[model samples]
Every structure is written in structure tokens, then in C-alpha cells.
Target: MGWARQKQQHHNAAFFWRYLLMASALCLVFFTPLCRAGAENHRNAYATMMYMGTPRDYEFYVAIRVLLKSLAALHVDADLVVIASVDVPARWVRALEKEDGAKVVRVENMDNPYKKQANFDKRFKLTLNKLYAWSLVDYDRVVMLDADNLFLRKTDELFQCGQFCAVFINPCIFHTGLFVLQPSMTVFKDMVHELEIGRENADGADQGFISSYFPELLGQPLFHPPANGTRLEGTYRLPLGYQMDASYYYLKLRWSIPCGPNSVITFPGAPWLKPWYWWSWPVLPLGIQWHEVRRQTLGYSSEMAVVLIQCAIYIGIIGMTRLARPSLSKLCYRRSDKSTYLVQNCLKLVAFWCILAAYIAPFFTIPHTVHPLLGWSLYLLGSFALCSIAVNAFLLPILPVLVPWFGIIGVLLVMAFPWYRDGVVRALCVFAYSFCCAPFLSAAVSKIMVALQLTFEREAFLPRLGESNPPSGFNKLY
Candidate 1:
């Protein structure tokens, strides 16, 4: 009788396991079509690029119209969706609406915060309004382009890429500028909710909100294209033209190069005053005449020298701080018995000199204009060095304190359940390496370089002073 009972129990367990496996298979089969259908409905059959701005801004209108004309030339066959928030005179909106392939969407919810001129806050409100307008559109693939952006080449190939979400590599953060989204009203609503939450939490700018939710909204469908001009391989795509950030151009000089034919120039923030408007003519390479034409027509290049100078100053400060840490530490020890005023003064002076040197390096190398290769090299090298130092100085010191705790957690997770050991162990390893080891390793390298005095020299390798200047025909104002 006991043997018979044991056999019955074994049969029951086997039956349960078989039932579970069949159920899992059935669920996968059932949802496969639904998932595929959702993706298909949002695929890039009809592409639309949305620009939200007030029509009353004449310069912005001119920039948008020129961009539309360029897109038309490209034979994109995609609709240009422009959302006008302000009370654009009926005539102006009508004129743009009458354009053959352009769709002017008027958003009534946009509030004019300032009674006089629109400011950053108003722009944010306008963006939200435009986002709402996008929700109403029935397009499959939607891209949000800043009005300052001028398309120099055809972007139909971008839609040809079989990705649901595509974005240009955002140079500052590990993100992108021109994002190709699978348009859905639900996703748009979720984005608005997240933005509202960000505003309430004081998390960051709107872009921050968007970036934070990017992983969730796109759900592993998100892709970052390669550096402009690279051939697409293994799902990696590039933008049509170089998408420029006005702030990066003016402040960082990171996007001054016309990397390839399909590069689109994008200017974040105010659209009217762009560095490219001034520097595009003289600096543009001979083969890239289309960019020059776009710059001439739109009157902005998304490049600026002042911003580049500021970026250099920032890099210099970071470099000097890293370089002077040892000296400062010694000074503190020597002055322990006395007032620390002398040491403080000396440190401040060092910082000031470093910043001044950094600021002036660009001027001495390339003054009055911008050079793509020289500018990008300085920006990249300086940023890399600064990041290396930052990691070493800040992150390395905390590793020893955290490593044991991380190891213990890893062991606990692994021992807690043998069935989930593989995934948990892999996750813990990634967390431990990323949070604990990477920073220390980077910092150690930076410290070693500093000790050897193998510092990066900005002026020696970059473009020499007066290499390029603003275009002769460029207007100071839009």
C-alpha cells in the first residue's frame, strides 16, 4: 500500500509539470500574433517629422519652410507636421497649410506664460502641446525635428531600417537627438504623465524625462545609430545628415563637421540664432554644398564659438582640479598648525589659471570661427580626460568600502534559489563591476597620467588661430 501511494505522488508531479509547460507554450502562441500586429500597425509606412513652434516667429517660419522645401526635394513622401501654438495670423497659417505636402497643426492648449516674449518655460509648454498634437496624428513612424534643423539629404532610407524606435546618438548623454518613434496615443499619454511627474519631482529638463522613460516606452526596440556616415550593419543605423545641437555647437563645437551626405543639422533651444548661420559658408567643405544651401536658406548652423569657449573653460577647470589635488593635500598638511588662508588662496589661483588657460586655448588655436576636425578633437580628448579623472577621483575611493557588501549580496542571491542562479549571478556581476570596479579602474589610470604629467594639450594639435571665421554675408540677427 505504501509503495502504491509513492507511485501515485510521482505521477501527479509529472502531470503538473507537463500541464505547466503546455500552458506556457499556448500563451506564447496566443500572444505572438497580437505582438506582431501591434508592431506592424506602428511600422514606418508613413513617416512624419513634427516641428512645434509659433508661426508669428518669422525667422522660425522661414527656417521651417526652407526645411520643408528641402524635404520635398529629397522626395521623402513623408508629411511635414508643424504645430503652431501662438495665435499665428490666419493668413500665415493658411499660407503654410496651403503648401502642397505640409500639414500645419494648430494647438490651442499651449499657454503663453509671458505676455511679451516666449521664454524657456513657454517653449516647454509648447513642446507638450506639440506632443499632444502628435498623438492625434495617424502616422506609423514619427520623428520630432527642431525647427532650426535643415535637412540636406533624403531620409527615406532611415524609415527603411526595420526598427520600431531609432534615435541619433546624443553626444552629451548616451542617447540620441532625432528619434524615430512608433507612434501610439497611449505612448504619448504615458510620456506626458512622465513629464508631469518630472516637473513635480524636479527631476530634470523635459529631455531627461523622455530619456528616463525611453527604455520603458520603447521596450528594447530602441536603437542608437552609428556615428554619421558609417554604413549600417547589424541593425545599427545613421541619421540622414549630421544632427547638430546648437548648444553643443556654440558651447562644445562637437558637431561642426559635415560627416557625410545624409547629415541633418539640428539646433536645440532657440532656433533663430545658430552658429552655423554665421560659420557655415566658409567652413563647409566643397563637396557639401547642400549643407551650405540649407544653412543659407534656414539662416542657422547650430554652431557657435562662444559656447565652445565655455566648454573649454569647463574642461580646463576639471583638469586643473585633478592636477592640483596632490599639491592641495600637501598644503593642508603643512598648514595644519597655522591658518589655511595661504593654501586656500594658492589653490584658488591655480584653479583660476587653469580655467583661463582652457578658455584661451581655443582662441589661440581657432579664433573667430569653427573647424570640425580641430574642434571635435579638442572636445573629445578633453572630455575623455576629464571623465577619466572624474571617475578616478570620485568613484575609486568608494570601491573598497562597497566590494565586500556587493560580494555578499551576490552570494546571497545565488544561494537563495538554485533555479534562478544563472540570471541572478549575471546581474550581480554586472552591478558589481559597473558600480564598484569600473570607476576605480578609470580613476587609477587618470591618477597615473597626472603623475607622469602626460596631460592633453589643446592648442598644439587643434586648428590654429584664425583658421575660419563667420561667413561674410551672414546676418548678426535672424
Candidate 2:
């Protein structure tokens, strides 16, 4: 009887062990995947917006691409989202999704109800589209950004912020250039309703509308992401370090913000100076930094071909003009005083137009979104080549014709002077340089006029303005 009882106890113990093992396997098969799905559903995303119809739509396209590619390079453990307007071209949409790895959220452009606001800028009409970020309910947290925000590091901890948070680059008003928000369909609907009602928007743009919506954000304590990996709830004021205005560094020539991670730099100032314009640099020294990120990512290849083609065209103009110089001079003729005067006035008018063209032509040909050095270089080259044509076509002095070219190079040097203690000093130096150049510029203008006048006196007009023999001194024009 003792042997039978012991064997029965052992059999029961083995059965219990087997049941426990089977239950554990079931949990692994079911519960682990659920946990993963929960984590994914609570995913974070870095989002920015792009709308069409603006004069700078393509520029912003490139800017958004750079921002997305830069974030990808940081290897942030979050999705990249572009809240692109529906009007954005299909090819651009495909590029953003396939090449840049951004999830493009096509949205309709939100009309600004506050368009009548006295200080509204028309360019920001569609910035209201940024409010669509709140409708991205699939993302637990979204750091909605402006394309000008330059990230210095992975700010995944921004995901830890509550429903809404933004950096106050100004004391009273928080900048909308970069902000953290929790996605909520309810909040998005309310924002849309507010837009319909024409809420008190100071700037008639997203910055004003959003700032008014979260007016109390200024009172919230600065957020500090808990070390235990817990996300916070409710509105908060992000430290200034998160959206450190690029202007702050200009005064000190360095970043000195003592709070939070100085992870992103925002250019909330002038639209033309927003880093990617190439001409924005030296003025905004941080532009080069933006370009560096672009160099590593999207690159200038999109515009490089245009630039190369332009350069080729300019070079051809110069070469062909130089070779055709003699033949062009042969077209000169002699005639009566009245006819000569009429011809002279016509030539002067044409020469003035050509000189103006020399200065303005490069503005259209060179890519507007290139590096400052490259942009300025192309401008100077284009100007020189075009000016050379005017010199060969009209009997003008070379030095006076090239004076504007020298002035541009000089202005660039002054603006690019690296030793200025602050922006004020830099501005003063530029002013002084310009003041000094005014006299030289005036003299060059006088010289150019005199040269034009002499051309008509020396190279006489034909009976019909193109029939007379070339003058004895006509060769000097070349």
C-alpha cells in the first residue's frame, strides 16, 4: 500500500509540471506579440509639412527632403512624416516616400480664416495645414516641425512630452518652428472648428492660431524627461535649448543655453535667410551647418545639372563674343550729325540695357538654393561673361564694365569677414564698406556713361545706321 501511494504522488507531480510548461508556451505565443503591437501603436514620429502654390514650393520641397534625410542619418527610432498638401506633385510624393523614407500624409490646404488680419503674410496661407499633425492618431507623439529646424542629435526623448509642448524662443510667444504634440482626432477637429470660427489669430498663420489655442503653455513647468522611460501628460513648456533661435548664437558666436538638450536650431527670423538659400550664409553662419547636413543627404545634384548647363552657356557666350569681336566692330559706320545722334542714343539705350542684364541675368540662371559661395561664384561668372558681350558689342572700357563685379566680390568679403565680435559689429562693417564703395560705384557709372558717349562720337553711324564703312579707330572697341 505504501509503494502504491508514493507512485501516485509522483505521477501527479509530473502532470502538474507539464501543464505549467504548456501554459508558459501559450503566453509566449500570444502575449509577447500583443506587447509588441502595443508598443508599435504607441509609436513616435518626426513630422514636417509641405504645401504647394507658394513661389518657393520647390525650395521648401528640397528643404523638407534635407530635414527628413538628416533625421534618417541620425537613425532616430521613429517614423519620418511629411504632411504634404495634396497639390504636391506625384513625383515629389514618390521621392519623399521611396527615396527619403518619409511617410507622406497628403492633406488638403486649410484656408486661413484670418486672412484679413492686418499683419498677415500671404506666403504662410497654408501653414494652417500643420494642424493636421494632431489627426495623426496612429502616432502616440508627433514632433511637428518646420523644415528650417536643424537637429543636432536624436531627440527621441521629445516623444516623452505630453499632449502639447513648444519652445519659447521669445519670452511671451512660443515659436512654432519646432514643437511636440500628442496626436488626437478630437483635438484636430476642435482646431478645424476654431479655424472655421475665425479665432483671434494675431499672425493669420499657424504660429498665431496654435499659440492662442495653448495660451497657458507659457505657465507650465519646463519638461524634463524622466529617466525611468515614462511619458508625461498635459501641456508643458519645452526648454529654450530645444528650439534655440539661430540669432542667439550670432550675438555670442556660440550656444550657451544651460537647460535641456540643445538638440535643434530653428531659423524663425527672415524667410529669405532660412539657411537653404545659399545666400543666407555668412549672414546666418548656421546655414553652412544646414548645408553640411544636406551635403551628407539630398545633396545639390538636383540643381547641379542646371548650374553646369548655365556655366556652359556663359562660357560659350564669352568665347563666341571674343572670336566674333572683329566682325562685330566691322558693322560700325559714319553718317550725318542727326543720324549719328539718333544712332548714338539707340546704342546707349541698348548698352544700358545690356549692363543691367549683366547684373540681373545671373539671378535667374544660377540655382537659388545653392551654397552662398557657389551661388555668388556663378553670379560673378555669369555677370562677367554677359558683361564681356556688352564690351565686345559696344565700345566700352573694360575696367568700368567690370567695376560692379569687383564691388560684389568686395561686398561678399566684407559680409564674410570672420573676426566680427557680434552681428552688430558685422552690420556696422558692412555699412561702412557700402558707404565707402558708393563713391567708386558712382565713378564707375560716370566712366560707363562717358565710354558710351565716346562710342557714338568715334564709331560714326551709317546713312541707314548700318551702311557706312567701319571707322579708322573702330578696331580699338575690341
Highest-lDDT candidate: 2
* Alpha carbon lDDT of each predicted model: 0.45, 0.85
Tens-place lDDT per residue, model 2, 1-478, is 9999999999999999999999999999999999986544438899999988778888889989999999989988888899988889999999999999888899888888988778988888888999999999988899999998899998999999999999988999999989999899999999999988878898899999999999999899999999998999998999988988988998777789998888999888888788998778776778889988888898888888998998899899899988987323345544555776686678778888999899998887778898777888888889999999898888688898888789888888887777878778888888998899889889988998887766654554333344454446643433
Candidate 1, 1-478: lDDT as tens digits: 9999999999999999999999999989999999866643442332222334543355455556666666666666466666665466676677566753567666565332222322244434444453453364476555656555656566655554332343444543323345555556787777666555443312233344455554443334333344463323323334324454343433322344444353575655433234333223222222133344554443233345655675677577667757664322211122221233344344434543443343334433332223333344454444444443433332223233233334434443433333333444545544664566556545644553343222211211111223343233322322
lDDT of prediction 1: 0.45
Considering summed lDDT, which 10 consecutive residues are worst modelled in model 2? Answer: 461-470
Q: With candidate 1 superimposed using the best TM-score fit, by how many Å does residue 29's alpha carbon deviate from the native?
A: 48
Best-performing candidate as measured by TM-score: 2
Q: What local lDDT score does residue 440 receive in model 2, on the 0 to 100 scale?
A: 88
List the pairs of residues colliding in candidate 2: 333-460
> Which regions of candidate 2 are displaced past 4 Å?
1-42, 326-346, 462-478
